[model samples]
Target chain A: MAFASALKCRECGREYPTDPLNVCEFCFGPLEVAYDYEAISRAISRERIQNGPLTMWRYQDLLPVDGDHAVDLQTGFTPLMKAPNLGRLLGLDHLYIKNDAVNPTNSFKDRVVSVASTKALEYEFKTLACASTGNLAGSVAAHAARAGMNAYIFIPADLERGKVVGAAIYGPTLVAINGSYDDVNRLCSELADTYPWAFVNINMRPYYAEGSKTLGYEVAEQLGWQAPAHCIVPSASGSMFTKIWKGLKEFEDLELIPKVHTHMHMTQAAGCAPIAEAYEAGVTRVRPVKPNSIAKSLAIGNPADGYYSLKTIQESDGDATIVPEDEVVAGIQMLAENEGIFTETAGGVVISGLKRLVERGAIKRDEVTVAYITGNGLKTLEAVEDTVRSVTIDPTTSSFEEQVLNA
Target chain B: MGVTVRIPAPLRRVTNDQDRVEVDAENLADMVDAMEEQFPGIKERLIDETGSLRHFVNIYVNGEDVQFLQGLETAIKASDEVSIVPAVAGG
Candidate 1:
């Protein structure tokens, strides 16, 4: 049974039927999935969730989709591992890393696409589409292939080679537009009006975004039904960061967890830090910028949820940090070297921002902090290409000893 | 050969359900004023009370976001295609 009640406008209190609509007709505000929490509270139980599949679908009661036609990729339910090594280095006592990099597509996009594709199939849509930075393209293609739907993925032309090849391997009609992600998004928005395809992030976004709340659900459940004090998340469009907080709050309201006191810190690359810039300037409006960051996945200049994310941070008493372009690779190296978790540039932005937060005394040393590692490092190898070093030796143990151990 | 203004679905009610409307104007600011003259209550939706474009709405001139160009002062010529779209988020 789907607990979602209606598609409500975030700005205006207008509600629409559960359809493939993203913007409110009256206010042009983004439409969000409003659920019948009373029903969810009655239906959901810790034991019921535990007995379900070891995936994001476990929280199906809170999600917007019915379980009848789910396009299951076995996504989500990622490991919430204790990051003792990195925590010690950062001067935090209890630190955890919600490693979403281990998802089906090696990124958290699988979670959203899983829900969106399932809804698309339920709506009887023949095609799946999105305007992706990198990760979402591959995810949409994979999910479309799984559900036997035609896929049309649009992306910026300058995206990473791994991401480009990743989507292409899934046999989707991947269109690399010669413009930024924002430009590609605008084109897709226009296309969504003309085409009948279910653009996951454009037309089918209300249901698609609900998938992110599962991340928050999984974290609290994994941590014994307790919300972390601080959650540092890398923000591109600020959707996931906001949704994660919403997830925690929903759990708290449902009496599934204690009152959520999670300080939702948002991290962004310095090259494209509109939300951080707004926070630093003490302004409510987010000014867009042309993205110039290696953390390309989090490079949405005109973030749709920028205002909502800023509001979430202020309400949570959390802070936003901007990581310099130079430190992104260093952040990636630190996590990989210490915790053996190879995360993409977005994760680097989170780690680097977390370090800055710690150094400035913003984050308490004893606070139970969780930094989200959203994507796999393998997809963005170019960001750390120079860091790849090898010991050149004649294939012999004597050469290894002489060149490495002796030297 | 006036500029072609492509109206999105949300604003089509104000445009008499017409998807595309043609108007004559020199710049985006004038174009908006012209649109207001043709279709009342649109300028308020596109622009906030502070006289800036609403954060939820984006105006693109010939496939380029007007914010990147000259914002409200962006120049528009004959046969130019202007699109008004609601901002949608995801990555």
Candidate 2:
């Protein structure tokens, strides 16, 4: 049973009916899914959650949607593996990789789209729409197809070819806007008001953003109810970073865990890291910049939740860092070589950010750290296209001996 | 001084479908007031009831964000080009 009472304004104290609304009409502040923790504390239990499906819905009471209209494609409940290889390399005792790269859409976006699509159905929206950098477009299209809803997915024109085909395969009306991710998002914000569609990250955002909490829940549960010492998450819109923090706090509030003192670390690619730039500059405001990065998935220049993300990072006493382009490539290669887990560019950012944090002594060597791997490498083969090409040899033993054994 | 504000498509309804409008105001807060006088519902869209500029709406003067300047109190000048760009988020 959903314990969600209403959608409450994040900036203002006003509450509104749970509807297909993103920002508050009165204050224009983002609306969030407000839940009754006291009621949830009583209604939910560990056994109850364990008995549910092996998907994100396992934490059903915590989610805002009803079970009846849940649009699911087996999203979430991904593996939380103890990365002994990566840990040893980083000189950390405990290192975990939240391998969400294996999701249905091969990205963490499936988690959010599942909830948003279901909530759209609940609200009787006929279409599922959104402006994406890449990952979200594919996820939205797939979810829309599953729900038999008309889908209109928009993206920046220069997105990865794989992501373009990924969404196109789902038969959504895909439109490529000739601008940055920020431009696409701006157009979607306007389109969301004009069209009667459920733009997952716009009109249906409150429900969509809540889906990220499952990542936190899964980590805690996988860790046997112990929160990690540090969680390094990549920031785009910065929603997931803050949501993970909220998730841990909620788990403790619901008595699922005794306590959580997790330091929320944020990762960003240097090319488009407005939040990190602000943090480094020691300013409370985020200044937007035009993005020029290979990590296209995490390139939301004017992040909607930048201010709040800054606050969450500061309040959690967390540290954030941005990885250079070369380090991003190395991070992906390091993970693939060390743990056999191939990840997208955004995952590389997380790994590299963790590396920088460790080197700078911001993230300690002894602390238990979980770096969120947000997407699969296959979705962004272009990023590693030139880096890891196989050596060509003649089909003969002599050729192999000369190219490999002799070398 | 008179300045031209390029309103985004979302807020054009309040401006009677005019994409750009020239308003005489000394500062951003005064510009908001002047725009509200011309378009009654524009202030509610741009600012919260508490009167602070909405976080999602970014106001820029001559290509520089007002936030880096003096925010709503940033002074204006004649021929200054003001643009109201909404924050782009997702992905």
Chain A TM-score of each candidate structure, as shown: 0.98, 0.98
* Winning model by TM-score: 1
Which whole-number lDDT from 0 to 100 does residue A57 have in model 1? Answer: 88
After the best TM-score superposition of candidate 2, give how far the Cα of residue A309 lies from its true spot, in angstroms.
0.9
Q: Give the alpha carbon lDDT tens digit for every residue of A161-190 in model 2.
A: 999999999999999998888778766765
What TM-score does prediction 2 earn? 0.90
Model 2 bad stretches (over 4 Å)? B1-31, B39-52, B59-88
lDDT of each: 0.92, 0.87
| Interface Cα RMSD, each model | 1.2, 3.3
Q: Candidate 2 docking category?
A: acceptable
Model 1 error, position B4 (Å): 1.3
TM-scores for the candidates: 0.97, 0.90
Clashes of each: 0, 0
